[model samples]
Target chain A: MSVTAAKGFTAAGIAAGIKENGNPDLALVVNNGPRRAAAGVFTSNRVKAAPVLWSEQVLKSGQVSAVVLNSGGANACTGPKGFQDAHATAEKVAEVLGRGAVEVAVCSTGLIGLLLPMDKLLPGVETAAAQLSEHGGEKAAIAIKTTDTVHKTSVVTKDGWTVGGMAKGAGMLAPGLATMLVVLTTDAGLENDVLDEALRAATRTTFDRVDSDGCMSTNDTVLLLASGASGVTPDHAEFAEAVRQVCDDLGQQLIRDAEGASKDIKIEVINAATEDDAVEVGRSIARNNLLKCALHGEDPNWGRVLSAIGTTRAAFEPDRLNVAINGVWVCKNGGVGEDRDKVDMRYREVHIVADLAAGSETATIWTNDLTADYVHENSAYSS
Target chain B: MSVTAAKGFTAAGIAAGIKENGNPDLALVVNNGPRRAAAGVFTSNRVKAAPVLWSEQVLKSGQVSAVVLNSGGANACTGPKGFQDAHATAEKVAEVLGRGAVEVAVCSTGLIGLLLPMDKLLPGVETAAAQLSEHGGEKAAIAIKTTDTVHKTSVVTKDGWTVGGMAKGAGMLAPGLATMLVVLTTDAGLENDVLDEALRAATRTTFDRVDSDGCMSTNDTVLLLASGASGVTPDHAEFAEAVRQVCDDLGQQLIRDAEGASKDIKIEVINAATEDDAVEVGRSIARNNLLKCALHGEDPNWGRVLSAIGTTRAAFEPDRLNVAINGVWVCKNGGVGEDRDKVDMRYREVHIVADLAAGSETATIWTNDLTADYVHENSAYSS
Candidate 1:
């Protein structure tokens, strides 16, 4: 169950001939709702794709009836003509759905600096619209995949409402949003203001903290739409919790399927002077190339950890820093403590705890190990 | 020619049994002069090695009699005991040379968080002192090699004066100083203040701009010692230029010898609003893993370059950015320009020019391509 797990939603995925390999490359999700309340977050990168520029304006209206996504060409840095293509695609989707052009949001992924094949894409949109069904969520998830090896979906159901979503990203996963396209649907009868607040709060911790690599994308987008089909108004706090749960689950799935990653690393910074300091320190550790390589080799090299922390502006005395790798406190008070040889790292998951001994603030950032396959996959082609 | 290329200096290198493989691991350089004016720079990383902490204090007097460097272990994150060991090493050198302990500076490179073996190190200082000679500069350079495949040295002879130095580093090379140890000696009769000003100016543009892998070290140190043997004080501007030339040459050597690097990339950011902005954008592009991988595969993926520029806070409009790879403009005005297929990247050196079109300021950064061999080397064992 993907987005279709929630009521009043139908989706479809179809091959659009955009990719030469004949893979499914077009997806459409529509809301048959009494209320079309929505919220969205786009990439923080200043160099945005044409589709992102279109979607940002569509999200400003806070009412989206449908979302059209494709995987082939990013349509980014393509100048004014690319924007026109996005506008025209939205217009076609609106014409078929009997909705306004402004009510349709567009998202694109794949290679940057290339224009989409509008002749094939326009026809594929009509085919996708014809195939729209309640059980098409999985198909839609499968279609919006470029290098992703598997499709991702998450569902969280409460007493009378359900929140569900889908995501696709295998690389270029970093803060300021990973290279991803996520669409969440709910039937909990929420208004635009509530949906916006909940989506922002949920994504701030989930997608914003997952840094598989220190590279941001130009087409990152996360949209949350409410159809109000359940006709049950839940408490705002409870509804926010359900949205956060779904987002957290999807974020984990993205990390598990990260490109060429052999180990999933969880970096937790504790006792920071502030939440921002914790985040800064956590990101510094997450983006350290040497430390990531050492962890990939299962070396438990805590010295590299201390060196990374020292590069940050976070408040912490060098002599007071402590670190634990996989439950072994190998470094204490900036010196050797437990034997590093005693630490076990035979699994796909690695946990590191860095204690600042400064205050009570804490944060966690998810990342992946740097491997030979990562270099090989990213080097072999332009993705 | 190495540090001893100048007059009134003697040096030696020997295996001190600190390295288990019995490679040369200790070096010594002495100033036999009427003046011992000196200036030094160390790593900006806060979690500094014990030798760095000790040498920082030794340089406060603006005078140095000798320098002792080792390659077997980096005594960092070892608490008070490490500091004591650094002090003891200085005392041993001072005793053997009949000088005050405060006049001796120490440097160390290799694995961090481990203590140096004083039993072998102290006796080795006596052996180095006994073997010191003006022709031993090449041997001293070889002794400071950790993972460096070859020892590096540079010399510039001017009108009645000479400047020469040696450096050793293979990885963990980044800004705020690469993981390197360099020593330069000049026979010109100059005071400490003049030496300090010229050394800082030289390093600001040379060593500090070399970012091989974006990983700073805790044991980086560069020192300049002046002996009054030449009895000729050259023009300040000419002296500074000679020093900068030597540093630039040594920095290039470090990048060429970078671990597992198949290509060296030079990122030039031009027409920025300020020098700081140019440097920031250049570094952001230099540290981009995706761009590095693309260049490693000889693919002119200029879109990745645009994406990296977007992440910086530099002053530039997205639609005005331009990028050139190997003199071919692959991206212009933030969109596609010349055909990427026309660009040639068969050589080991790649040049990337980013035109910000904001102002007249410019900066350059040197880095290396991300390779599977890099992962293999860093993962095979701890550095």
Candidate 2:
């Protein structure tokens, strides 16, 4: 179950022939409800995709009746024609659902700088609308994949309400909001403001910390909708927590399915002067190609860690800096400490602790190891 | 001809037992002159190596008698003992040359966070001092190799004077100041302040723009020594031009010999609001891992380049940007333009021209492609 797992929602996924391989490339989710409330987040990249620009405007009304997503072409960098294509896509969805054009959100994820197959996409929206059902979520999730090895979905249920979501992205994942296309739905009674507040709070910590390849996407977007079908008014704290948990689960799935990744690294910056410093230091370490390669080879090279740290402007005494691989302190007081050979790194998960010794603030950044496979996948991706 | 191409300089390189592989690892350069005028620049990294710290102090007097360098172990992060070892090495060189310890400069490269073999290194300096002669710059350049495939040296001769230099570093090369160790010798009669100004201006545009691997080292340094043996007080502009040419030539050599590089990429950002903005944007493009990988595979992926540009805060409108690869305009006005298939990339040198469409300011940054051999070389470097 995905977004359609919630009450008063229906979804359908179909093979639109937009993909040259004839795979499923279109998904539609509709809110069949007495109340329509929605909130969304999009990529902060200045060079945003056409769909991102269109959805940002539609979401301004704080109400959405349906969402149309396709994954054969990103519809980005197509100039003014790309903007027109995204508008036509949203208008097609609105006409099929019998809703206003401004009440439909749109998303596209695939090769950039290419026009969408409007011939296949516009007709596919009509077919998807006719087949929409509450149990059609898993199909919708599977339809929105480009290089992703598996579909990702998460569902959470309480005594009287349920929250469900799905995501699609295997590369170009980094901070600055969602970093991918995610759609979530809940049956709880909530207003647009409450939904927006909860969604922002959840993604601020979850989706904003997953940096798979250090390349932020231009088509990243997240949407959340609410319906009063369950008739349960959830507590604000409880609703926020549920949203965060769902987003966290989806973020982890995205990382696990990251392209050409052999290892998942968790860089935990501890005892920094401020939360921003912790995050800055952590991001620097996560983006160091040399350190990422060392992690891939399972070499406990703490020198690379220190070198990365030295490049940052974080305030700390060089001799007071400490680093640990797994649980062994390979670097203490910024020098050789415990035997690096004693630190075993034969696991898929690598934990790195960088202590800045400035304050109590901390942050954790998720990244993937650099591998030859990563190079191979991305090298020929666009061609 | 390298540093020894300049008059009044003697250099030697010897096989120091400090390297367990029985490779040549020690070099010595002596300024045997009537007038010893010297100036130096060092890495801006807060975590300075012991040799850098010692040499930084030695150059404060605006005079240097001799310079001793070793490449087996980088005497960094070893605390007080490392400083003591660097001081001891310089003291031995000064003792053999009959000069004060403060008149001798020290430099080291190779694995960080390790102690130098003082016994082998101190004796090796004496051997190098005894063998120092007028045409030994090539041998000195070869002795400082860690992962470099070839020795780097450059000479500019003009009007009865010459400026020559040698550099050593294949990775961890980025710009704060000089990101690698270099020794330049000149016979043009000049005062310490004149040489300092000329060297700074030369490197600001030459060596400081080379960002091979985007890693800043703790042991980066560049030294300049003028012996006043030619009795030619060259004009300031002419001397600065000669210095720039020499540094430019050596910098190119460093890029060609970058570890695991199959292609040398020159990212040129033009039409920026300012030179600093241009430099910032160029460096960002040069350091993009995905773009580098695409270059390694000969894929003309302009989306990665656009995504990289979007990450910078430089003043440029998204819709006004244009990019050309190998003289083919793949992207125009921030969108697709000419056929990407028209671009040719079957060469070792690749040029990327990004037009920011903002102003006339421009800058160029040099970098290497990301490859499996780079990963293999850096991963098992210390082991």
Candidate 3:
């Protein structure tokens, strides 16, 4: 159970003949609620996808009865015709579900610059609505995968309410949003404003910090819907913590399942002048291809870390900086410290701590190593 | 002849026992001039190498008698001892050449965070000074190789004047300077201020735009020395053009010899709102890992180009964006246009043009395709 774990929700996933390889390409989630409330976040990339534009408008009404997602085409950079297609998709879903089009959201993922196969997708919406079930959450999670090797879902329960979510992403992952589609559900009887505040506060530190590739996408969207089935309006802080926990779990899953990744790196920047500075330093370290390659080879190259930090405008003194790899302080006071050979790196997880020595702020960024397999996977992806 | 193509320049290269493999690791280039006028540029990286710090201070006087370069260790991130070593190397070079220590510049390249072998290096400087000859430019070029497969040199001869240079760099290349050491010799009877203006203008469009792997180095230095032996006093514009030509040639050589690169890509952004905008967009396209990998596989994935453009704050509308790969406009009006199959990419040189349709400014950046070999080379480089 993903969305349905929170109660008062049903979902369906089906093959819509949109994918040439006959993979499941369509998913629908519906809220059978005494009250409907929703919040959403989209990619900050200026060139947004057609479904992103449609869903952004639907979310403005602060109510969502259903969400339809497909994984065979991104429907991005497709011009006005693509936006029209997204609107048409929402209308079709509304017709099948007996709801207003404004209460339905649409999402798409996969190859950009191609129009979706409406002929197969429109009829599949009826078939999916006819098969809606509480157990269909897992299938819905699986249907949104593009290069993801496994479906990701996480849940957190309180005394009387719960929050759960599913995410799909593997490559082209970065900040503002990764190239992903996420749907979260809650039965905490919260209004749209409360949901919006909690969702924003939770995602700010969770999904927004995952910078796997430093590549922002045009079709990233995350959404949350409340059904009020539990009828318990919990404290805002507790509900927000649950949302953050689920989002953090899903983000970890995204990083662990990153494309062709051999190692998952966690860069933590400490003693920064401000949170923004810490984030800047963390992102710079996360995006350094040379450093990533060095980490992949298990070389404790502190110089690459220093070079990455030098490129940022964060507040830090070069001679006062320090770096630790795998809990070994390989560099201290901007120079060689402990013996690098003593650091063990045979594990799949690598942790790098960069001390800015400026103030008392910290931020963490998650990334993966640069490997030959990454080049191979991306080089042959479109062809 | 390389630097010796110009008058009043003598150079020598020798195996200094600094490299374990007995490869040539020390080079000395002396400007035997009646008038010694020089200008230099160093890496903008805040965490600069000890050699870079030493050379930057020497260049402040607008006079340089000689340049000493080594390839065994970068002498970076080594703290106070490294700075003393760099100073000692310069002092030894000045003593051997019978000049003041302030007139000698030292450069180093290799793995960072290691101290130089002063015992071998100081003795090698004396030997290099004794063996300096007008025909040693080729050997001097060969001595500075790190991962470079071949030596790089360029020369431009004009009426009674010549500008020539030698460069060494194979990896860790990006804007604000590549991981390179360049020494330019000119016998055109120019002042340090004139040479400074000319060198800055030349590098701005040439070396500063070559962004391979988007990884800046801590040990980049470019120096130009004028001997004033030709007695021509040629037109300033003509001399500047000659300097730019030589710099452009050397920059091209560096790109062609970029480590593990199989294809050279020229990204030209046209019709931008400003030249800065064009440069920003061009650099963004040049540094896109997905686009580079796709180009390596000969796939005209125009969507990646659009996606890269979307990430920048440059002035361009999504629908008005167009991209052409290898002379075929694969993406027009931000969507699919001409057939991608028509864009032939079967050559070692790949050309990409992004039309912003915003203004009339233009800029070009040179980069290389990402390959498995790049990962292999950089991953095992320092290990």
Give me the candidate number with maximum DockQ: 1
Docking class of 3: high
Better of 2 and 3 by TM-score: 3
Deviation in Å, model 3, residue B132 alpha carbon? 0.4
Task: List TM-scores for all candidates, in order.
Answer: 0.99, 0.98, 0.99
Best by lDDT: 1
Better of 1 and 3 by DockQ: 1
Local distance difference test, each candidate:
0.94, 0.88, 0.92
Off by over 4 Å in 2: B177-179
lDDT of 2 by residue, B176-280 (tens): 753467999999999999999998998888888999878778888899999999989999999999999998988888888888899989989999999998998
> Candidate 1 on B196-272: residue-level lDDT in tens?
99999999998899998888899999999999788999999999999999999999999999999999999999999
Q: Candidate 1: list runs displaced more than 4 Å.
A: none
> Which residues of candidate 3, in runs, are more than 4 Å off?
none
Q: lDDT of candidate 3 vs native?
A: 0.92
DockQ of 1: 0.88
What CA RMSD would candidate 3 show?
Answer: 1.0
